[model samples]
Target chain A: EPEVTQTPSHQVTQMGQEVILRCVPISNHLYFYWYRQILGQKVEFLVSFYNNEISEKSEIFDDQFSVERPDGSNFTLKIRSTKLEDSAMYFCASSKPTGGNTEAFFGQGTRLTVV
Target chain B: AQSVSQHNHHVILSEAASLELGCNYSYGGTVNLFWYVQYPGQHLQLLLKYFSGDPLVKGIKGFEAEFIKSKFSFNLRKPSVQWSDTAEYFCAVNPPNAGKSTFGDGTTLTVKP
Candidate 1:
């Protein structure tokens, strides 16, 4: 089965540095999303993207966060400046936008660690 | 605010034992419910979902869940489990007409062989 794929399985960066988490969602999927799981915590939604624009976002997705589909296949989440609290496993997910109860597929996740 | 709550944080069961993971939602409106599982070293995978029709819904891996509207609950159950069933289970809910979903804290099941 085709699945979402994320790059840089493990990323470490300085607190004030920038980082980009990349994802290649299922080729045919129309909906994309970014989510995070702090250690021992429930997964939290960050943002959902569709038609090259943000469809929804959580409070945690503040000014510092931005997502873009720079190309047809890649969906990237960029954090302008990182913080200690930003450390978590970032997972990329995708689904069909047709919206008749479609299941979302998830990637293995990128473990972001800000020093 | 909409939220999901899973009552059991950790459960340890032996092979062939029955399993039940409690899940409840705070949303009082029409809702869609789902159960997802994450096995060790793997990404999260959907188990089952409830939209409408029969409250009893069966999912993959011989698992099933019943949605109780009045109780605001969707509990997952399996008559017998195997060691392969060891994983973390999450319950999620999306209120009617809402695009986003709220997820449970999750239940970690450890099935000993």
Candidate 2:
């Protein structure tokens, strides 16, 4: 089965530095999403992207966070200035449909550590 | 907002033991229920899902779940578990008519040999 792939399995950055997490979703998938899981916490949705634009985002997806589909196969999440609380396991997920009941395939997460 | 409730936080079992993990949701509308497993040092993998049709659903490996609409529950079960079954499991829910989803805090299962 086609799977989503994320680069930089682990990332360490200073509190004020910019960080970009990259994901290459399944080739045929049209809907992409970014989710985060704080250590010992439930997975939380951050943003959902479709057609090269954001369809929905949570309150945690503040001005400092942005997503871009720079190319056909790559989707990236940029954090302009990281905070200590930004450290978490970031997961990339994709689905062929954005409909309510469609199944999503999740990639192994990228662990981000902000110091 | 929809949310999932996993009653068990952690469970420990010996090889060949039977397993049952409880899961419930707080959505009044139709829901798409899912059970995902993340083995130690591995990515999340789908164990089972309930979209429609018969309440009883079978999935990968020896896992199964029964979606009880009236109870708003979708609990995962396996007749026998191996050490390989030791993993963190999450119960997730999404309204059948919506795009967003909510997941429960994971339950860590320890299977001893």
Candidate 3:
């Protein structure tokens, strides 16, 4: 089965440095999303993207965070300045626009460690 | 605020034991409910989903869930479980028109042989 693929299974970055997490969603999927899970915490929604723009975002997706679909297949999330609290597992997901009952497929996730 | 609550944090069972995981959501509008499982070092996979059909929804691997609208609950159940069923399960809720979903704190299930 086709699945969403994320790059860099693990990353360690210095505080105040920038990081870009990349994802290649399923070819036919129309909606993309970014979510994160802090250690021992629930998965939290960060943002959703559709039609080359952000459809919705959460408070956790603040000014430092941005998402882009620079190409037909690549979707990326960029953090301008990493913080210690930003360490988490980042998941990218995609789904087809099947009316009201769309189910999303998740990537293996990119573990980000900020020091 | 919209949120999901999973009743159990961890559960241990022997092989062939029946299993049930409780999930409840707090959303007033029409919502879509789902159960996802994550095996060790694997991505989250959809186990089942409840949209607008019958209250009882069956998913892959002989797992099922009942969507009780009155109680705002969608609980996952299995008649018998195997050691392979050991994994982390999560319940999620999303508004019909939205793409973002709110997930519950996952339940860790360990099945002993």
Candidate 4:
């Protein structure tokens, strides 16, 4: 089965540094999303992307965060300045909107550690 | 203020035991419900989903979920679980046309062999 793939299984960055998490969604998927889970916390939605643009975002996806579909296959999430609270596992997901198969397929996740 | 809730934080069970995990959402109107599982060090995998039609939906590995619209609940159930069934389970809800899914806190299940 085809799955979403994320790069850099783990990353450690200093506070105030920038980080880009990359993902390659399934080839045929049109909708992409970014989510994060703090330790012992629920998974939180950050942003959703469709048609190469952001369709929706959450409060956590403030000015510091941005997402881009830089190429035909690559989707990335960039954080301008990392904070200690930004440490979490970031997940990338993609889904098809048609045929009543809207369930998203998730990547293994990139563990972002801000020190 | 849409939110998903999973009642149990952690559950311990022996092999062959029946299992049920409670989940509820605050969203009304047209919504899609789903149950996902994450085994150790694995990505989230869709176990089952309820969009329309039957209230009870069966999924891979003998897992099933019931979407009770009246109670705003979509609880996951399994009969005679095995040790391999140990994993973290999450309940999620999303609007029909939206891409973002509201996920519950997740329930960690530990099945003893």
Candidate 5:
């Protein structure tokens, strides 16, 4: 089965440095999303993208965070300056809606570590 | 704000034991409910979903969930579980038109052989 794929299974970055997480969603999927899970915490929604633009974002997705569909197959999340609290597992997901029912498929997730 | 609540944080069971995981959501509008499972070192995989249909829905691996609209609950159940069923389970809720989902804290299930 086709699945969403994320690059760099693990990444360690210095504080105040920039990091980019990439994802390639399923070819036919129309909606994409980014979610994060802090250690021992719930999975939090970051942003949702459709039609090459962000549809909705959460408070956690602040000014430092940005998402782009740089190409037809690539979706990326960029953080301008990483912080210690930014360490978490970031997941990329995609879904195709049918009659108002949308079931998202999640990627293996990229573990981001900020020091 | 919409939120999902999973009552159990961790559960231990023996093989062939019946299992039930409690999930409740706080959303006034029409919502879609889903259950996802994550095995060790694996991505989150969809186990089942409840949109608009019968209250009782069956999913993969002989698992089922009942969507009780009056109670705002969608509890997952299985008649018998195996050691392979050990994993983390999450419940999520989203509005019909919106793609954003709110997930629960997740429940860690360990099945002993």
Candidate 6:
């Protein structure tokens, strides 16, 4: 089965540094999403992208965060300046909105650690 | 706002024991429900989903869930679980046309051998 693929299984960056997490969504998927899970916390939605633009975002997705569909299959999340609290597992997901079957397929996730 | 609630935070069971995890959501409109599992040091994987068919939906690994629309509940169950079933299970909900999914805090299942 086709699945979403994320690059750099783990990343460690210093505080105030920039980091880019990359993902390759399923080829036929029309919606892409970025979610994060802090240790021992629930999975939180960060943003959703469709038609090459962000369709929705959460309050946690402030000015520091940005998402881009840079190419046909590549979707990326960039943090301008990472904070210590930004350390978490970042997951990318994609789904095709076929009626009520908008079930997303998640990537293996990129573990981001800010020191 | 949409939200998911997982009643059990942690549960411990022995091999071959029956398992049930409760999930509820607060949404007023048409919604799609899903259950996902994350093994140790792994990413989330879909366990099952309820879209528009029958209320009872069976997923991989002998897992299943029933969607109770009136009560806003989608609870997962397994007839007999094994040690490999130990993982964190999450319940999620999304609107029919929306791309974002709101997830519950998750229930950690520890199946001892």
Question: DockQ winner among the candidates?
Answer: 6
Ranking by lDDT: 6, 3, 5, 4, 1, 2
If scored against the real structure, what TM-score would every candidate get?
A: 0.89, 0.93, 0.92, 0.93, 0.93, 0.97
The candidate with the higher TM-score, 1 or 4, is 4
Ranking by DockQ: 6, 3, 5, 4, 2, 1
In CAPRI terms, model 1 is classed as: acceptable
Model 6 lDDT on a 0 to 1 scale = 0.94
Clashing pairs in 5: none
Tell me how far the alpha carbon of residue B60 in candidate 4 is from the true structure, in angstroms, after superposition. 1.5
Error of 6 at B93 (Å): 0.8
* DockQ, cand. 2: 0.55
lDDT (tens digit, per residue) of candidate 4 on B1-113: 68998999999999999999999999767788999998877678889998899999999999999999899999999998999999999999887766579999999999999
- Expressed as tens digits, the lDDT of each residue in A1-115 for candidate 5 is 8999999899999999999999999999999999998876778999999998899899999999999999899999999999999999999998887767877878899999999
Candidate 6 similarity to native, TM-score: 0.97
TM-score, chain A only, candidate 6, equals 0.98
Judged by lDDT, which candidate is best? 6
Runs in model 1 deviating more than 4 A are A99-102, B95-99
- Report the C-alpha lDDT of model 3 over A1-115, residue by residue, as the tens digit: 8989999999999999999999999999988999998876789999999898998899999999999998889999999999999999999998886778867788999999999
Whole-model alpha-carbon lDDT for candidate 4: 0.91
Cα lDDT tens digits for candidate 2, B1-113: 78889999999999999999999889878788899998776678889998889999999989999999889999999999999999999999876544456899989999999
Candidate 6 lDDT, B1-113, residue by residue in tens: 99999999999999999999999999989999999999988899899998887999999999999999899999999999999999999999999877589999999999999
Clashing pairs in 4: none
Query: Could you tell me the lDDT of residue B25 within candidate 4?
Result: 95
Interface RMSD of 5: 1.6
Given the true complex, what DockQ would model 4 score?
A: 0.58
Q: Fraction of native Cα contacts kept in each candidate? A: 0.26, 0.52, 0.56, 0.46, 0.56, 0.72
lDDT of 1 by residue, A84-114 (tens): 9999999998877444455567789999999
lDDT of 4 by residue, A8-104 (tens): 9999999999999999999999999999988767789999999979988999999999999988999999999999999999999998886544678
Off by over 4 Å in 4: A99-101
